[model samples]
Target: MPTPATSMNEFLVSLLRVPAVAARDVDDEGRTLVSNDVTGSSQLHEVGPDGTWRRLTDLDGVAAGRYLPGRRAVIVQHDAGGNERGQLSLIDMSEDAGPDVLPPLSPLVHDPAFVHRLAGVRQDRVLYLTNRRNGVDFDLVSRELGTGVETVLYDGGGYVGEVEASPDGHWVVLTRPNAPANSMQLLLVSTLDGQVEELTAWAEHTHQSTPSWLPDSSGFVVSSNAGREFTAVVRFDLDSRAWTSLVADDEHDLVGWVSPSGEHLLVATNDDGAVGVAVHPLDGAGDPRPIDVPPGGCAALNRHPDPVWSASGRALALTFSSPVEPLYAVRYDLASGSLSALRTPGAPAFPPGLVQPESHRVPTPDGEQIPTFVFRPADGGDGSVVLVVHGGPESQSLRQWNPIVAGLVAQGHTVLVPNVRGSTGYGRRWYSLDDVRLRLDSVADLAALHDWLPSLGLDPDRAALYGGSYGGYMVLAGLAFQPARWAAGVDIVGIASLVTFLENTSDYRRSHREREYGSLAADREFLHEASPLTRVEAMRAPLFVIHGANDPRVPLSEAEQIVAALTDRGVPCELRVYADEGHGLAKKANQLDAYPAALAFLAHHLAKGDGVTGTVTNIKEDTE
Candidate 1:
């Protein structure tokens, strides 16, 4: 569970590789090892095997919780400098009564020049997938933890993105992209000889996500869009070269892990609009036994490692949020089948009547019903409002902690977040709604919300459009495409140019871009027409742009290019590029800086008579 602490939207959720359960002293330090988002200064402490957790580091950004091969503590730090670049750090908590010693493992891997993807650590060597050596692709490099000597196993061009090492570290799963349209083929690579074996053929347009190795390490499980509407679970045998489907449902299913007990496999499934965390058996059989946990909703389960076959099958930590609750971390006991809360630093639950988000559906111009989450403060039904757009165009807006919305609500403003069109969890039809040409539909749906806002007893003139990634792109679309609609906009790591965005993204995201935006080479004119960069001359609102220098998904150039254009046109715009951040902010300081910057921008533009005026040029480096 990320942070079962009553505060939802304290952070946003992403699909990353997380260990199902972490080993901690149950009697002393409790179960959770680190906070939800892997922030660097993450009060990241762990209960020693003897039952006590102590603070490990005092630096800024830290995350990517990797437990060393033989250590009882986590060993990776994310963006320690608030520069958006993650620094490798080793946290030693083996001592029962003292503060953990955390030392920087290597020079920080900052954006544009260096991007680190934590692969695996064996013996005293740490393996990382980095784009530092090659500008276009990633390379597997091994670094000795003590001496910091680095060795390249393979450059990213031949093999795929991050390599998944087998249990005994004898094999690795590599993702290979097929030509013509750039789809992916999952392959098994022999670590000793560097031999590649094709596991999944690129026969269709479908793709593969993170693949987890079974405890035996001889076989693995991958989430793929094989048969059903959503992604399905498939178990692959390395020796037999055969594959078996675990479960075929209309919803997408994520492989939590092959249980430590090997008897029950944890799976998070999106059944219709709701998500369920269930336990399934191996051997392609049995009905999925749903584990009763939480306040009746959940997603993103983090599993534990080691103790090979524990009676409890390790712990399952997940984030749960629903209509009645905000997002919080909840740990499920595999042995006792119990759920408990995990800690979050300063965030607290929204006081009752302070604000409550009501979920509803707004009809698009084409008769499509879009899901929307509206947060109204207690002061009055009428207040300044903002439309928070979610990224992905392919991603959905669930009931969770939205800092921007929550902050606005605290400042006596109402907030509206719409699932819009092309969001997931609503089936493939909804996801396909944001495909290139239909991109404007979701942007239009956001605009339509303004008309619906008044009916819900809100003010439209007090509205602003805020989003990151795809949501960032939508901010530009809403402002430039219709100049007078929004008073301000915030674009965080958003796509400004479809052509440049595709051309500049990392190899790992190449295939998914096609799945969402279509091919730039073939749809050249269409991409240019839809890109926000091409229409910057039409923008009229005050704009705020934040991007990570190392973002492989959208690239820092996206933000630079757009901000430069807006500046060239004399449009009011503020651009911030974190030196080490990628895709999203992982450091708490970055979060602290980002959230306040966004609030200040919105307040300057839309808040009633706070009266702080034009061209305020205060840009200070965040030291938090």
Candidate 2:
């Protein structure tokens, strides 16, 4: 028998060994195609009804597999070095012919500089979104599967949020994001006549997404926050240009799916941070009935545009994970309302009774109650705490399977993750609280959370700030703005300077980021003022910085500039750069190297009586 994990490294090893199903899709034959990390690298794997897993690809990248309509083969989206520029390759499941990159779909196969997203692949045609034209905005394009003829379906500008085709293949719905404001509009395009009709007007602060067509093709269903504080299921009519609210709730955001037959719609709503599923009929006959979801965290049930309804429409597949549970591909039977696990590869081996996080509301000075999750050891902790802030200022800190938090808890440190004012799932007003000039308000909220930790018996002064991307920025901000509050900090691919990040980020993602952060041209002064680099002089805590050299979102320069400044100021700092990764550490090998180093760094600095300071470690570079 394998020995139980006792040390931090051993605990991390056991947790990371648990494979997570990143993306999954089911076919007509009940075979499930999943992209999992069972082989250290996230590759394509097929799971049969007998629960046997067969590896499909051995590539070293993140692969999201989806079976074609006829189930003859699968189309996999693969990206290299953690870059978001994904390419589509068709894999012949029968002959083991490996994955073949379609020439017509990917004209520049050798170049990994652009991003290609598969919208929908039918029998004879493939629709996708690409920024090949200007590298700034994604354009909707389609290619014939047999003849290799590529055609531009929509040449409209701005970021294409989603591209979905009708079941009949005569119409396509495009979701175009209007940035600098958290909103998007839907456009309906006809394939035969090339006519485009705008379904939604350009509205500020109104968010709309996940459009599913009705079986009859007369209209479509979408989740919209228009004229409401939370997202609601709304039905749109093509002929009358009318929108009717199908399901509305003041407290939750409704996200659901309309069956292929158009008889019933399944809507998932965010009850605070947890997911709740409700089924409603399309004919406006009766009240919406609730569908039972498995006890644990549901992966934002309504987040995906395409619902994973089985070919028979009797069952739906969903990916779910909990604080102690590894991600699993589960199937929920519509008729019986029963949820069964289809693939739980690494779950059984994981030790039971891990630390369960407790939800709390930390009140900020501005009268906002931040939703926070605290993970502590059974014996409380060693008094020191590590605050793990999440990215996407717009994203919420959900209860998911996170090895990093578990490892921190194993090391006798209390871990606190907070969903601050800007986090989603609370409501639109809460999400918009940290925009532009008010960005630092969210940072102040973090300070409030730090001040409130003492009430929970955690030592406030002995805390360390940890996060990546935007959260990484928060780490730097926590040290700079509230220097005396934290003992140390760790930032992974975070932004040191907002101005440089916005200017250097990929063109296609610039506007979407600008919507969260301020615009470069319009809010130049405010952007620079909110940057952590501007307040670097106030940073007294020792720091550890980790970044990917190939990071396209927050470039490597963000790490380099901050590290150089901290080192020159005689502040102790450590910098690690991985040449083979991007943004965050995606590959398991890189993660093993980075996360362990992070835990060690925190232990050395934030440990009870470690007062050692002013010793700078030389920059370490990993090319693995």
Candidate 3:
């Protein structure tokens, strides 16, 4: 990444100032609730019916909230200084409250030491998951809105993930890891009784969605791939204990949920890197009607527990973005088939000649075709190439809006985004390829991508590796393991030593992360060999590192040690740490500072001649 300069170009500043809506919730009255960055920092905002904007929570860090069913109150999840140990709070949105701002967050579930994730909302109660019991096992708990009373619904053995509370409040369907890192099991917990039952035949690594209830509350619908490769929507009936498939595709995965009226289901199909959405009838009698939106990138759902439908179930709201556009929120009406923006994200303006993503597959050494989304510079290919890795080794690189990639293209850097092995949205087998000791195989995918870049008229030696979290780990690993291929690298909130990261990370995360990265107890030797710090001696590419001081996932020390080791070896390194961020840069001011400098660094180092290296003379660290 580039170090800081006194000023940034006008186009880059415009790119940084572009606002986006990440997620949203729609109330019964057709009002929109969103977590948008128009306020500089991401906070909760309500878009009223009359085109007026109401600021909800003015927290320094990001505030995520959702509308409670049929009520004027909302449940907000907030955290301190980006530690990610979220606490639940309620803000009164009743008529008595001022439109200027809602009341200060009323503590609903406040314990800084524990993590409380809000799962689903019902009539007068909210369901959530917490680790407050033993700090290791997560329990399913629900709280009343008026009385503030609590009930621990399910405390099964251990490892409870996200769940769906039945509409009638009688049952809750659960999804959790069933030993294997890439697998999950579907279970049902009776809210009225204490009994827990497996929802399906026992199978390891079976993937399923959170259940969507039927109108009568007898059974539910879900997308599961228990006995097949591609996902299909299956309906389970409690009376007969029979399963029936409603919607499926031979080549693509069909994921959807039933509408409030149970008349139709909004189904999304994943084809490679593009998405297609449609509405299917529950009877499986009619053809699926396609939705009219952008062809490539569209999102009908968001992070909130609320359904995308309005209270009346007549309107559907979704947020959309692509490589050429920033994230914007929109609504679709069923009867009218009309689409409108809830509120235009920021100004919706950018430099002219923004480019679209081109889908390609780079062949790997092991003969696997790695799916990649490449963005070319509008000014032609006079500059260098950058390989942007998506984090979550579990996550795929979608065709979504990215300010960094757009800015780089504007500056003449062609960006290649690849979904290597171990990325989801493909299939179960593809998702588990790099678990534990197979970790280095994914790093080898990056080298193969660089080797194949020459086919597109790009120089393999002039390429750079850029990513965050797991992708950041790839950046450092590429610079170290394949030192001759890359001219520079940029890492953000990534891991250096898997062994140290597993040991120093938050206590609640160690066991969960151990499933992805090898466990220290059994795989210590392999962990050391796969770590970038162990091979830091061979890293010669100029490197830039960015991290949040309070990141609970990847510790700040991961950044400190890697930069220190490289500097001691006389390799040029620069580090920028955001004191008030975690995981990644959250606030716009910090991003405006960090990204510009990182881009400057890439522009300098990648322009060097053949075997011309050491782009920086001295190491620089910014903690201010």
Candidate 2 local Cα displacement, residue 119, angstroms: 1.2
For model 2, what is the C-alpha lDDT against the true structure? 0.79
Candidate 3 stretches greater than 4 Å from native: 1-8, 96-99, 157-159, 200-203, 300-307, 344-348, 608-624
Query: Which is the winner by TM-score between candidate 1 and candidate 2?
Result: 2
Ten-residue stretch with the least lDDT total in model 2 = 101-110
Per candidate, the number of residue pairs that clash is: 29, 2, 5
Model 2 regions more than 4 Å off: 1-6, 96-111, 284-293, 301-307, 336-338, 344-348, 612-614
The number of the candidate with the highest TM-score is 3
Give lDDT tens digits, candidate 1, residues 1-624: 122222322322111111112222222223455444333333445433333444555555544455565555455646534333445656555554444455434343335345576676565777777666554466777777677777676653643543566777777776655541323578777767777666666565455655767877878877776555667777888789888887667645454456634566767666433566677777647777676654334454211121112223566555555434445455566667666655443434334433446768887677888877777766653467888888866566765444556566655567887888777666556766766677777678877787787787776777788888888888888887877667888888888988898888876466557656777667778888888788888876888888877676888888888777877776778887677566766555566667666777786688665322356232424332
Query: How much is 401 displaced in model 2, in angstroms?
Result: 1.2
Highest lDDT: which candidate? 3
Ranking by lDDT: 3, 2, 1
Q: Global lDDT of each model?
A: 0.62, 0.79, 0.79
Q: For residues 532-606, could you state the per-residue lDDT of candidate 2 as single tens digits?
A: 999999988999999998898999999998999998898899999998788888787778888888888887787
In the range 243-305, model 3's lDDT, one tens digit per residue, is: 888888877777787877788888877787666677787887788887776877745422222
Which run of 10 residues does model 3 get worst, by summed lDDT? 1-10
